[model samples]
Target chain A: MADREWSTVDVEDIAALTAVYGGNPARWPADRRAAAVRALAMDGAAHELVVNEARLDALLSMVAEPEISAARVDSVVAGALARLDAVTAPAAAKAAPHKLDTFLPSPFDLVRTALSWLSVRAPQAGWLAGATVAGILVGVMTMPSATLSGAETTTAQAGTAVETAQADVTDMPSLLFTSYTVETHAR
Target chain B: MDESVQPQPRVGTASASAAAPYAGNPAGTLMGLGPEPGDDALLARIAQGDRQAFALLAARHAPKAMKLAQRVLGNAADADEVVQEAMLRVWTGAKNWIPDGRARFSTWLHRVVVNLCVDRRRRPAFAGLDGIPEPPDPTPSAVNVMARQQTAKLVSQALAELPERQRLAVTLCYYEERSAADAAQILSLSVSAVESLLARARRALRARLSGVVQDTGEV
Candidate 1:
């Protein structure tokens, strides 16, 4: 079957082709490129799209490719080598594990790792310490007074109840026993 | 090119016998390989921990990688960092690389560079000025250099304002001169989708830079 004729190519397809492939029809898909070229020649809107896209392409072309400096290349390659070494070193060490090392790390090992990390990252440790102190200070300052006041009030209430009990004992029991004894003697 | 003479890094012993073929160049050597080695072949050697092959691959591809990075990242230092990191990944992952024949090594590498650049752009650590470097002039004419710098600044600003996908499409298609098909692979988009992206990007760029760049039609 023959390829679709130029008259069948729509403006939207032409515009999209222009956008993706730039203003050049030769660079468009081989199947539709012939029809697109014909359409560009016939349709004013399609021509306008190509012209506008060409202007943008011109601006894009003005943006030149930056030169990669030799120093930069060296630096990047060095960094890559260093990274490769760093990655392989651990694997190598793991392959030839120490006789004393266990499959699971001991507490001492964990502590040593933590200490090493802290030594290497002292700033992070400082930040953590500062955060902990700040949290403690904030907690202390913001604590509600109701708990302390409630404890003090309970202590005072207990003391008053004890004194009241002592006063009642002193005022009542001896008189009741004396009255009983006098009644028995009169009988 | 015997198996006993190829240069190997001193760190790893897994592929020691495999590193004997290309021993002349060491890591970080930027000298040309004279003839281009097939990417697959170099990758095969790289999988064997051949540093010379890696060096050759870097020399072959670094300039293009840097160009793509610089365009996407818009800063020399950031571009360098992203490329370096991508290259590092390429190094560490080469042993596991299975060439499925679906994409070329360059395409895969381009994707790596693109992803890293995009991630860097999103990171808070992207503190450098987000603008393309000014074109260097050998003669150092003050007025011409200034005008070019201003134009680059405007273009960079316009590019920065674009949506991430659109910016990527423009960088791959226009700046890097990649075909729509290859760019789609790098962007993980369909060919038509890349076209649509480029169309929208060009429209946006045209609108943003209407009066800035003189459309001489000569370019």
Candidate 2:
């Protein structure tokens, strides 16, 4: 039906259409568009009403769009970033830069390093690992009681075993736990 | 397109231009010209105070944000100031953002610009349409051309006379080429509310401008 000119609109309809859509047929409601065009062409009063609307459309069209300048984009971004620096500067001061290679190795890197170390010192690593297991088992299973009144000789041997175990196992625990415990306790 | 006719920061021509896709760029929705989808990462970078990330986000949205803001405030410098503050908020306030998918970055961006415009608009002295001057000169081409340039102030003043919501609705739906749904999202109103505001606004502006834009009989 919109393909043909339809005389469905009177001047009032023209008034209503123009009020909402202005004079631009391109902007008119699609269903009533052909009717509005026909009214404008055939009726003088309808033409008058639409022309008034069309005039406003033309006037409104005279207002220009703001230019989207690249310079504005750069300025806005720079402004925001600067403000962000101002905001976060205090907290950012606590951490050393992430670029510092000497600060710490990742866990995977640490493990790889240990593996390489052990390969170069295989005899020492074997001795250390075996001694660590032995010390742990001995500590759990038997203790040198500060006093074993009836068994002085056995107590003496137990004391020797405990001393040996404690000496051998200190390396692993201190390496793993000292830094962690120090920081935890410091906090 | 007319070099002879320089327009101020007005709503109507923006709408006319917006009635077509912006600059004939098929991909140009308000957001289309900005960063593509997945601003969550961008916001995360912003949250971490990554300046480059913030810059990336700003480049995508600032131009459109500026246009919307200037239209609302009716001044380019004021709009620039508002968008500056808005972008600053995006920077400083990004840490608080949850980056939830519930709202697009543009939605928040629009809200920020509109809210700033509303705040700035509160201080200005706006008048009603009671004393607008007569329409454009009815003479031929030369007078029309001069009228187009001269009437710019009256046109802006006439637009400023409408209720803020009416003005915003017209700008959003017409000049920005935002759909009712999109306008609704930006303004946080129902789609029907946006449609009604637009309808009322068109009529009010028609009466206000007083046909300063002459008819060429194309309608």
Candidate 3:
């Protein structure tokens, strides 16, 4: 609130402000207080109006407000906390997300678990035994695709086959003939 | 309007500190030494479910909140119920508080209290008008006490008879001693609108209290 803000304030405005705020210039809006005080100092009508309002202020002053009790503040806090606890207990029991996380592992948890197992130091004899078995399996499993079961080519062989197929496609003039030719080649 | 209650000037000159704008204890809870945690920081903690911070905030503010609710509802029990609900929102609804726009936490609390008071007003009062406690008048020794009580009852009754917004404006400005700007902020009205409400309320109160004022011997 500033003095300039009250530049538009007029006599009527002062009277209204006085009727609402009483005779105390201190209680008036800050921006308009100086102007109001100046207005009242200069104007007899508004000053009388404020003096009349102050009498009502004196009359309204007799009402005894309820006394503040330390016990009541305690009671409100106790009552609120109790109610909050009661409500929260049932709510937390139903579908607590934090609790749910304990039962249902997250993707990060799965990844962490996998990494932990991978980082574990296996026995040297166990590693040697595993390598021997894998080498034997690889040696016995190295056979032509036709001899093996359906679609059981090694990864590199499958990739090469895909490249050869794509090469044929590149050489084809149109997709209609290409599909037919590929089907024929498959047969 | 409480003459005995000389409320310290909260609204200062334009150059006064604007950091704390709320009329009700602008600096939330202060401890020894440097500035204590403000309402915003406390709210952040409450949002994280910190019960200690919630209790501290409640203790710091619930008295004023309780008083405002009591004045608005006119029943201690109903006032307690609504203020508690408002405090519960402070705990449960802390996440909903937006930190921008120079918003004060106490303003949020007062808004919740006022809105709750308004909602509570819509329902039929279980106690009705008869429930307003009229102090038992007796004994020559207590004439002063009786007179004050009677005057209080007359003023309160007159206040009750006023329109809802007018009564609220009177309560906030006259009783609570909140500045018009602060009252406007709580009521979500323009400053002039609140002033208009206060002015209208003052006129109604003046008309109603003509006999009472004459009896009080105020020239």
Candidate 4:
């Protein structure tokens, strides 16, 4: 089978080709330039379209190219190099971690150290630990009783009471501190 | 501004030679050379952190990039900023630049410049005022200078009113003198699509600037 080439163009195609490539068919794509030339030669309307488009191209060409200063070029080059440096710096940094960063403690390690310190150095550490264990035991022991009591009361009311208690517990620090300050001042 | 309409120096010809002396001197060299390296070859070197190759590529393409950006952005400062940012991307992304063979490096750079200009236009910093700056004319006669400035202003106004894509197509094809295929690659559009945009843009510009265009006569 012989490959078909575009050897003919319609009015619409000619108009579009002129609009894009300008009035010169030579500037059009190689495959379509032959067809465009043929169309221009055969059709008067297509020729007229080319003439009209040429006027537009002429007006466009008259619009001068903006002048760029040597200073502007220098600035752009300098700025680009600076920006490239900035971008690559971070990337290079990420590729190789900082020496100081390696010496810094991880979050889990920090938590384990604090616990160990408290167990060794703080007199109140045993009391706090004992209180936490008792609280957990009480919470476990009272779960069934609380469930049984809530069966007699509305679950909604029980939930509201639990929320109130939680809020009071959250406010305890301020109350304790205030009373402590008042006692110290009175003394 | 009118003088800018004259042809500019080609990127890699005399300019490349002028920059050749600094090729190997790291402290003083702005760009490097490797036996008349093309855009692709320079880019390959740039990927390896070759400062000379980067400088050579910048020298080769920066003028066209600046002109394209200025046409779209309408301000020299903003255009310069866009080119700077775009070139920076070119440098940073050099390693990742996969040559598709369908589009040239220059075409890829054009797309970068166009995209940056569009993004700059949408920024609130440029809102409310006209983007066009009056061209500095060195003509002795005040009348001729004013006339050129007026014509340039009218054209800039008409161009500024175009949609982003239409403006990009016109900048690439008309101002940059790129072929339809090149413009298509720059705009990331099919050739037919670029043609349609050019058609609509021409119609709108003709409608807006017909009276000024007629009055200007030669322009």
lDDT of 1 by residue, A1-187 (tens): 1234544587888876776768866456667777788888889999998887776666666666777765566666656655667554323443566676557899768756765676578968856765655665565565432222222335556455434433433323333333443333333
lDDT of 4 by residue, B26-64 (tens): 322334443455666667777777656676667656777
What digit string (tens of lDDT, one per residue) describes model 1 on residues B89-180? Answer: 77767766776766577788889999999888787863555443536666756767677666766777888899999999888877776777
DockQ, candidate 4, comes to 0.21
Whichever of 1 and 2 has more lDDT, that candidate is: 1
Give the number of the best model, judged by DockQ: 4
Q: Say which prediction, candidate 2 or candidate 3, comes out ahead on lDDT.
A: 3
Which has the better DockQ: candidate 1, or candidate 4? 4
What Cα-based lDDT does every candidate model obtain? Answer: 0.66, 0.63, 0.67, 0.67
In model 3 chain B, which range of ten residues has the least summed lDDT? Answer: B10-19
Model 4 residue runs over 4 Å out of place are A1-4, A10-12, A38-43, A69-71, A89-187, B1-22, B25-33, B126-145, B213-219
Q: Estimate each model's TM-score.
A: 0.63, 0.52, 0.65, 0.65
The CA lDDT at A145 in model 2 is 29
Name every residue pair that clashes in candidate 3.
Answer: none
Docking quality (DockQ) for each candidate: 0.16, 0.14, 0.16, 0.21
Candidate 2: Cα lDDT at B29: 24
Model 1 lDDT, residue B146, Cα: 72
Instruction: Mark the regions of model 1 whose C-alpha exceeds 4 Å error after superposition.
Output: A1-12, A41-45, A89-103, A109-187, B1-22, B25-35, B125-149, B213-219
* Native-to-model Cα distance after best TM-score fit, residue B189 in candidate 4, in Å: 2.8
Candidate 3: lDDT of B122?
A: 97
Where does candidate 1 clash, by residue pair?
Answer: B3-B20, B4-B20, B5-B20, B6-B19, B6-B20, B6-B21, B6-B22
iRMS per model in Å: 7.4, 8.0, 8.6, 4.8
